[model samples]
Target: MFLKRIVYFSRKTLHLYLQSSTMSTFTSRINMVTGNNEWIFVDDDDFDYNQELARSAFADMLHDHERNIQYEQAIIKTIQTLSKSTKKIHVLDIGTGTGLLSMMAARAFNQTINSSCSLRITACEVFQPMAKIAKKCIEKNALSHCIRVIDKRSTELDLENDLQGDRINIIVAEVFDTELIGEGALRTFSEACKHLTIDNENLRIIPARATIYVQLVQSSFLQEFHTLKNLSETNQKIKIPDGCRHLAGNTIFDLNANEIKNYIRPLSKPIPVFDFDFKSLNDKTNFTKEKILENIQCDYDGQIDAFVMWWNLDMDEQGEIQLGTIPSWCYDDKEKEENVQWREHWIHAIYYPQQPKIVKAKDQVSLYCFHDEYSLYFDVGISPFPPKSFTPTFLSRSAVAGFNNDNRRNKYIQALEKSFSNTSINRCLYIGDGLLLPLLILEMYPNIELIILQSSNIHLAHTLEEILTNSSKQLNYRIIPSLDKENIDFQTIDMILSEPFFTKSILPWDNLHFYYLIQQYHHSNIKLFPSKARIRCIALEFDNLYKIRSPVNQCCQFDLTPFDEQILQASLNVDATIEPQSLFEYSSKKPTLSSIIDLIEIDLDKISQKNKIETINLDIPFNVDGICNGIAFWIDYQLEDNIWLTTGIENENDSWVNYSKQGVHLLLKPIEIKTGMKLSINAAFDFQQGQFSFNIIS
Candidate 1:
């Protein structure tokens, strides 16, 4: 009989289960906030929810294109960019969510091979439900032979000494949200690199860099997450975050709802600020970038939403895994997307020229930014406020914003017409947002080569249908979804084309954490909780991956006309995915469900024991939003997680161990192991002064 299950679990769940499965703890009063009005907004320990309502609401989000599918595209793009070595290549997919990355790598390899070369893809995800779903998809696509999904985390990639041996050619994960600090990107990526990146053997990280642009805006809708709202004792409010530290050099602000709405202060001119590279990054390392302008300016004041960026990993000669190359999206591991949850159009933090940048002024100020890893500053002659312009300095919508001058697009065409005149680039591929822009370039420049990256049609096609049909046509260029159900655009887009979306999982540090939490929260809301005698499956066209009987609710309400046409029709026939492993195979294997859960339970027990004895001093200068400056981390002790996760930074260094002036802390509570408890932690570092992790004997 099929049983109902959840995608993710909470610390409390893990804690309770680890303590004793027989205990079966359940909260009497569940207060889950539905939206801004229902923002319990803090630890779940205090909030409760109606099981049915929570389940129903969550199921809706699972299929929501605006929310969940965006992430699907992220994994898709990350996977599409990965390489499958000519020889047998070993892969490690962290947070394998539906095994998208694993499948992409496997598919790429299998496609490139003539049947002799084989590749293996192993994935680690702590969420059992997500693992199961991934396993299902992997098996459905017949990838189970090469890709194995483990319900564990990257930190736990080291198993009972069995799953270890050869280093992986790729370690792909899409854990980062907006804020770099939230997604445990630092910890997971570092751990994976150390474990997988042996001496000189190369490995490719999907996103080589995550760049964040900091801009000033005027919006009060996002004050809650941004932490810019007024704190009141009666409202259970807290101090606002560093969002208001505007010209004070606090570039990135992890805002909340109220902060988003209350932010009316405007520095109109778009400036190029803050560039963080994920590659070659260290806990305490420093770097700079050169002349980047992802941030933009609008005609009117608006909330700083996001500065969209994409990955561009350079491959070695043989195309085996190689590091050191930089992807386009670079952030200082700062900033996030969820900080503004209400609006769906798009959010951005623009950086315009002008020192004492004006709130309102009309003048043409030539802002030349020398943004680099070593140093960053701009040459702004005139420009009071960041400035008010209808057109932006950068366009992150998609491939329209090419990585280099060669990307065939209208901007490049304009540049070409002005600079190269008749000369144009040869052989070009555009990845990430902005398909129409390239088409415009095609119309204008005619001679340059063009390639478009469409991460996922199942994700955008639905919305794209609505978007394309409703939005006014500015030009002849139109990115219409194809008639096929699975593919997006089959015939290459010279003036127009779209590739199935699939790329890197890693992101800018701020976005890494922020969006990670948002995804978890959103996923929790959208997870397909299986019901008894029933199975839940992604309604992939042609062949639905549904089970006959299950207990969980299976439903999603989102317009998919765009996705269906754009993606499905793009392909004449939808190819089946990997096969699904039996529930028995998943739960009964040697290091099977019980075995893995048991290991996690043991660790959870240790954490519970430690938690009971001693609690972290949240009063100390840190929180999920981030830690206040002037804080130092002390390595009091480490956990036995077989990773750097064991190491926790203390506010001060003990006499024995040396502490970094600025270090990161794995901000998650000890793993909680309740069977159905699911929660997402917004862990952050205290920077100069903060502490994470705790241990004590009661």
Candidate 2:
């Protein structure tokens, strides 16, 4: 006998449960925006035990040809070098995602002619699903005879059982993140050297060494994310509490250096901070926390706001084969910089100093760099010994940064000022998580009574109280957790305002919560700050970003098309219709393949009294000859007939809003289109369900 049960986790997640006397399985549906997980029980017959393979980001990593080529070359170099001294070479590929590196080792051995030395390659993948995929991938390429795939972590491999007592002389692994040590590379190497590998002169690691580099930059733009700023050039200032001042700026943000080149002004030349020798990690001291202080000369006269960090990997022993994550500006060769392989798996990172420092040209400032086994951080000048722990700040650093955007704030301020000047708005209601809009209104219009409706996020409510306590302005405002007619009179409310940034809204369009609010609390006399919103979209031709969604037919002469099929089937079953991405981070020569078109125009005032489905169909034509890989869309708030703000590309220059993620609907099959080629798009919006659907016919 079997029983079926359904459980509700949150508004964002739904879970269904199925149970039998003999067996039970759990499945989860996650709400991307809220990041809530719902678990469900599924029948054994319906569930695929191997579905975990679909979750791996191997396609993106495997598609990185530069990384693949470098690893292969390094493996070949190590194998050839070891062959000269030793009769046999044993290689271990740690965290082997697709067995690509192990297969490369095998191919290198096969290429060696008349060689008495034989090759034995063992690859370990902790993820069972990926390990299965790696086995199949190796078998498909007919390299299964030479390479053995183990479904266990490197630490779990036993010398006698796993390797048959073979001493691993050559180790090839790519266990790294944006931060050189963030991925537990130190511990992995320490364990492998201690237990799995032979520590000898002939032993070689693919990436023999890594050097971390840091550059100081003075940018008010980057500082905005770390600290709060004055509200709209007004006397009322938003202040951070003394307790929260020591809070470390949020997690390190990884970005493409090319995308942020315009925003940052370099204060110092790139300085080599730390070096990690992977081949010589036998010492226990290498696993301990270490701090180094280097005096960096400030090149320009400016305030040092943040530091940008990147690393270079010496892929081979001689350091001839190299791979780095340095920005284009660091490259001396123009061609090399222009053709720099864009990799999603690895990129540059930015770290914020706890406090900004003022420096002049030729000023010598002590740059303190610290790293543990799995993380890295930076400090400037004399700092506390052992460093202060990151204080808990309820506010998201990214959100604070978005709130400080000058352009976005200016737009909102202008719209608000214009609306206040023209219309006599008295009782105003602000609905959203952010306090910037409501606070601006209070500062500008002190006489108007303002009520803030924050449905959730107690932290935001507390932050607002702290700001109000610190603020000198005597403002007429009230913060309400939820809307209640008994406590407040909605009938008298003249204006409703929101940045439309709701706590639960993940996608840009999810802010349609604004529309829903206006509908429920309908008053014919009420005015909206954003009178309407236009959903605009443009077809894009991504150079390499498309590979993330596309099928990998072959990676280094290995047929892994089956992996693509499995991922596609899994994605179809669970993936969201639209994926949000910071398009600015993705690099391309010519991104736009079509002229911007409006899919739907939503009038806030004219929202249907009754909940119903609203949809639109349009024929979109290509303006350029390119492959249409995906369509990028964003919301443009019509603050007024003339005053508008867009959450998409800023202008014709192709710069996007750095703070907001635009929605991308990647096409399952990319279409090669020419000028004037038209694609029919049927877009639907379900108001009742609060969902969106877009179907494109090429």
Best by TM-score: 2
Q: Rate the local accuracy (lDDT) of all candidates.
A: 0.32, 0.76
Error of 1 at 363 (Å): 8.7
Candidate 2 lDDT over 226-339, as tens digits, reads: 677667454544445654442224467666667677788999899988888886664555665556565678989999988999999999989999988888877889998788
User: What is residue 317's positional error in candidate 2, in angstroms?
Assistant: 2.0
The superposed Cα distance between candidate 1 and the true structure at residue 67, in angstroms, equals 10
Report the lDDT tens digits of candidate 1 across residue range 1-698: 01122212222222134343333333321211111112112223212222211221122123323333333334344444343334546667787655656766765665553455556778886756446656776676677888888787778766435366766655666554323334566566666776655443355565444443333444332222122122223422122223221211313222111222223444343333443344455644323224434323444533333221111222222323322211112223334232212211111222222223332333333344443222233334432222332122122211111221121222333433442333233433333333333433444444455433333233332333333233232322233232232433333322221211121211111111111112121212121100001000110111101211111222222222322222222221211111111111011111111110000111111111322222222212111221111111221111111211111111111111110011211211222223332222222222111112222111
Best by lDDT: 2
- What TM-score does candidate 2 reach? 0.90
- Residue 550 displacement in candidate 1 (angstroms): 16
- List pairs with backbone clashes in candidate 2: none
